[model samples]
Target: MSEATADVRDAQLAERKRVAAATVDTHRDALIALSHRIHENPELGFEEHQASAWAAEYLQNEGFAVELGVGKLPTAFRAELRTGPAGGPTIAILAEYDALAGLGHACGHNVICTSALGAAVAAARALDGLPARIVCIGTPAEETGGGKIILIENGLFDDVDAAMMVHPGTEHLMVRGALACITLTVRFHGKSAHAAGAPERGVNALDALVTMYNSIGLLRQHVKDDVRIHGIFTKAGDAPNVVPHLTEAVYYVRARSHTYVREVLEKVVACADAGARATGCTMEYRTDRMYRERRNNHAMAALYQQNLESFGEHASQPPTHGGVGSSDIGNVSLVCPTIHPYVAMAPLGTAGHSPEFREAARGEAGDRALVLAAKCMAMTVVDLAADPSRLAAAKAEFAAAQQAEAAE
Candidate 1:
């Protein structure tokens, strides 16, 4: 538009950003308390009743209409804030609060969920009287179950124009993506007999499992550089004297693309088949939940980075080839323009999902990162709500990426 109009819009956008940042600062203590509470509790996927309740309650107190148990998920919730009319874009701020099985908050989901909550509230406060909609979605089960995938299936993300969330990591990264992944459970059955006394009468199932493991090791050499096939022996027989009649293993097959990961999974199953045939054992396998590779919206990520760097905290470039994990948020990215940027909470080279990471998530550095992430995200929301063209650009980028994938 005209220069005067452009200047007016820019002034409004800057004011909205300032208000959003101030709102986050106004509730800094409460927001940090919420994060620490969730970190202390450490609920697992789909079982985060307390965490979900706490998040919903916090949003409700801020004048948002809160709904829990959406999509038939007990721990999932949705908190909505409407600024004026209903025709504006519905921006979703996703929250992930599930903890690891034994590690407890090692994945730093407490930071993820709380930052999202803070951003949503602050953005709503800043965008008051503006024609926009802000939604804070509490998506459980990112660590195990595909909670976001299930929400998508239930049409939770059908109307969302865009989504965003921040994750805690060892370094700040604006554009990192995850691998497509699926888990496989394999079982081999045979006859059992005394190993020392009647070894000839027994069909060794353990031997079959060992053979399949070795075959997978060989197959890894032939796969793509980004493909990863890994497994663990779940059932390797009870005792040494007794010939193992049944053996089981769980394998995770991952790749940069969903189709490629499935192809690799089939190869893994073939390896199991060969092992069963060579050892005279019968083999059966099944697949678990699949996670799509993340489609990071570069346009949206760039906006987020601009806001993040405005705080004087720089971000590192993500690896070009590998060094990534899978998440249910990838499924959300497929549904809407999404950004899952990272904020550093620990020293560089620190491994995630470990005791070190878990401690850092609850330490002083983590607290600072949590608040900074909230302000960055809140400012980004201000950017999108203040300028419609920015959101359109992000959606265009996402649409083009989807078209490219479909062509392949």
Candidate 2:
């Protein structure tokens, strides 16, 4: 381009950096407060009313046009900010704030939500003359209902060019993929009779449950090493003198991919069926909608890695072997250019969903993760907005990956 144009671009970038630096303290305080507030009032799954409202209000006050209750979920929301000329790419920043049932913010969703909000705000303030649309999506029920999958089905991500979100983990790293999973519930029914009157007249449902558990334990040896099957007896016999008439269990089946998960699920279900047959009881099973494994966009991930490196943090290398956990964000990656990098909240090797990790999530390390993740995400957005070729590369990579997955 012309010298004048180059000079103008340089000036714009300088201003963007200035704005980013100036607003860091302000955004940091807001993020810290947001994290604490959500942590204190921990709401489960799709019931994050107060957390959702807080995010919506924060974005609305910062000039985004906010819409609440998107995708038939009370806690879901969408906030948009447009800049420069129209017809530009729309980039989405997703925030998840749902807590675990009894563990509260043990999964560090409070950190995830605040970091995303901070990233959006930083990007908005640094846009300068870039032509782009910023959308902050408040997705609830990620802990249970898979909110993003429902939102995707409802066309919320249809207009977006790319999406991004960060997860807090024990180490800072870009995960290449996650296992696909399915949730299931199993029930057993049998005839009930008074124990004192006649033990032979009653069929024991508890026996069926025990048999099923043993069957699954034996089936594990034949399954793939990467596959995981776990369950809990939700219901068992009520009283000692009464012949139990019903028993129930909730199970989760996971595999390296969605196709493999289906295969593993069928085998597990057959085991349960065998239990029912052997115990002379009726069996019923239901599988919740399957969750697809994550497909990370390498191009996007690399960009974020570069930004993190600039801040003196080393981006983690992808694993050479073994599999990680599953996430609903995996579903979103199937349809859009996405990044689900992990920001360190605890020390390396610290496991998630435990009391130790939960304690670390609210400490100094977690706070650092909040700031670093926000900065990395915001800088990546800047790179995308200023470099057309990078955006094109991201989209091209996403398309190729989708095509490969379809062929498989």
Candidate 3:
């Protein structure tokens, strides 16, 4: 409050930063090795058994109470270092280790998980003056399934004062938009028949699927500018001479807000229904949990940007073009004061979810970005720990954001 208190706080923050930097410096090699190991052994969402075990063990060796298989997710883990008893300020360092389906680590989740681990370990060492609980959450299935959504439903972030994580990307970005998404699989069933002899008896399931796909393509133009609709044929007729009894397609509907996504999704599903009705076939559809859009906390994001600037690498505004994708972290940001910023790991134009991005995820640039991200995150943790009021401001912002969403 007073100048003397401000001076004391500044001195404490400086000391914390020095210790935090030193801690990350001491474990640089190990962190990189961990990141590369995870990259090499890529696993899909909800199936990161080895990666989760390795991360939990690393935090365990650091003296954090490790618990694997939390929130009904087999690969999810919660490791914590507590300074005192209950009711202490709790900060969460999120770790995402799941890789893409074909492109291993294309999104650089290995870097994300290790950066969180490094920050947790580094910040835990400098809690002498600032007493708080530092938690490292091993969240799986960010690439496919919504593991963070599952964890949140199970109260994974009940005590979290704030949450933060850094993702490696083509540019250093302070904050970016993540669209709300719905992924679904639609299947059409029909009666099969011999194409050459009795084709008239066939229901033509493949025709139904093709019609639905085309209808979706046409529906995209009618949706809003921010809406995105895409689908791929996962299954079709098996043989040319035999009519298809079953055909399947997977579709993804995305928009900037969950409400808008639902609205667009209704029309998208109607297209499929029309295809089925026209083809005299029955359609069945299934979807996983919906991913909400990110609610970036301005106060916390500003703090993270300041910390990143401390490393001599300035973070710039997010790209104006290049429509944003989706992530499970969006779900977390909706519930907590969170920041999912980015540090550069690849070149200026490397496209994510591609082979080039996958290769660059394990290169020298990724390693350097990993260390810088950890340091920045650790410093930001110190900022929140030394001055709890900042975290309070972040929470205030989060509450207001939630209120605005509720009103909408």
- On lDDT, the leading prediction is 1
Per-residue lDDT of model 1, residues 1-408, tens digit only: 999999999899889888988998988889889889999998889999999999999999999999999999999999999977767889999999999988999988888888888899999988888889999999989989999999999999998999999999988999886999999999999899999999999999999999999999999889998898888999999899999999999999999999999899988999999889999999999998799999999999999989888888898989886679999888899989999999999899899999999999888877888889999999998888878999999999999999999999
Better of 2 and 3 by lDDT: 3
lDDT (Cα atoms) of all candidates against the true structure: 0.92, 0.86, 0.89
Residue 149 lDDT, candidate 2, scale 0-100 = 89
- Shift of residue 172 alpha carbon in model 2, Å: 1.3
Clashes of each: 0, 0, 0
**Ranking of all predicted structures according to lDDT, beginning with the best and ending with the worst:** 1, 3, 2
* lDDT per residue as tens, model 2, 83-200: 6777678889999999887788888888889888888888877885668998999999887999998999899999989899998987678756688999989999987888788889
Off by over 4 Å in 1: none
Q: List ranges where model 3 is wrong by over 4 Å.
A: none
TM-scores of the models, in the order given: 0.97, 0.93, 0.96
Q: After superposition, how far is residue 139 of candidate 2 from its true place, in Å?
A: 0.9
Query: What does candidate 2 score on TM?
Result: 0.93
For candidate 3, the 10 contiguous residues with the lowest summed lDDT are 82-91
CA RMSD (A), model 1:
1.3
lDDT of 3 by residue, 308-331 (tens): 777788787777755599988899
Given candidate 2, what's the lDDT at residue 273?
91
